[model samples]
Target: MGKFDDLPETRRRGLERMEQVYGFDMTDGTGDFFRYTADHLFADIWERPGLSDRDRRLLLIGLLSGSGGADVLGIQVPAALAAGELDAEELREIVIFLSHYAGWPNGARINSIVENAVAQASRPPK
Candidate 1:
C-alpha cells in the first residue's frame, strides 16, 4: 500500500478537503503540525456544513487582513481564485470594502495580493 493507505479516516478526509479547497494535492506534508492541519483544520472545521467554501474564504480574508496575515493571504488568495470561489472583481471590491475596517495598509496589502493572483491566473500556461 502507499503512504496514505494507513491514514485515519479523518486525515484522509482532510487531505481530500484540502485539495478541494486549494486546487492541489496536499499529501506530501509531514509532521504533527501537518497532521493537525489536515485532520483538524481541514477535516473538522472546513468541512462543517453551515457555510459554503466561499463564505469561509470571505471570513478568512477578513480575519487575515485584520491580523496582518499577508503570507497566508498570499496562499489563500491565489487558491481561492483557482478554486473559483471568488472572482477578480469581487476581490477588488473586497479591498475597497475591507479598507474601511481592516485599515488602509492591510487593505493595500490585500489589494496587491489579489491583483497579483488575478494577473497570474490570466497568464497562459508556459
Candidate 2:
C-alpha cells in the first residue's frame, strides 16, 4: 500500500467522497493532480488531528466563497452535506455571512450553488 492507502479510515472515506463528488479519475486530465490531491491533500493534510471535518468544511466553504470558486462548490457543498459536515441552514448562513466580507456577488453565486447542491442532496440515490 502507498501513502494514500495507508491513510486512516476517516481520511480514506474523505478521499473516496471527493472522487465521488468530483468524478475524479486519472484519465480525466487530472492525472498527477488527482494523485497528489488524494495522497497529499486528503490523506495527509485532512488526516491531521487538529481540525474536525466540520471545521474543514467551513473553512473550505469560506475560501471557495471568497475566491468565487463556484465550480468547486458544485461538488463540495453537497458532499459536505452528505458527510454531515454541514447542514442546509448553516450553508445558507455561511453565504449570508460571507456576503458581508467577500462581496455580495460572490456570496450570491455561492448561495445559488448551495441551493442547487441542497436540492441534489435531497434526492434519492440511484
Q: Which candidate achieves the best lDDT against the true structure?
A: 1
Total clashes, candidate 2?
A: 0
What clash count goes with each model? 0, 0
* lDDT, each prediction: 0.90, 0.76
List model 2 lDDT by residue over 1-126, tens digit each.
633466666446557645654444322224777667765776567768998878887888899888988888887787788777788999899889999999999988998988998998889999
TM-score for each candidate, following the candidate numbering:
0.90, 0.75
lDDT of 1 by residue, 3-101 (tens): 466788888888888888878667647899998899999989998999999999999999999999999999889999998999999999999999999
Quote model 2's TM-score. Answer: 0.75
Task: Pull out the clashing pairs in model 1.
Answer: none
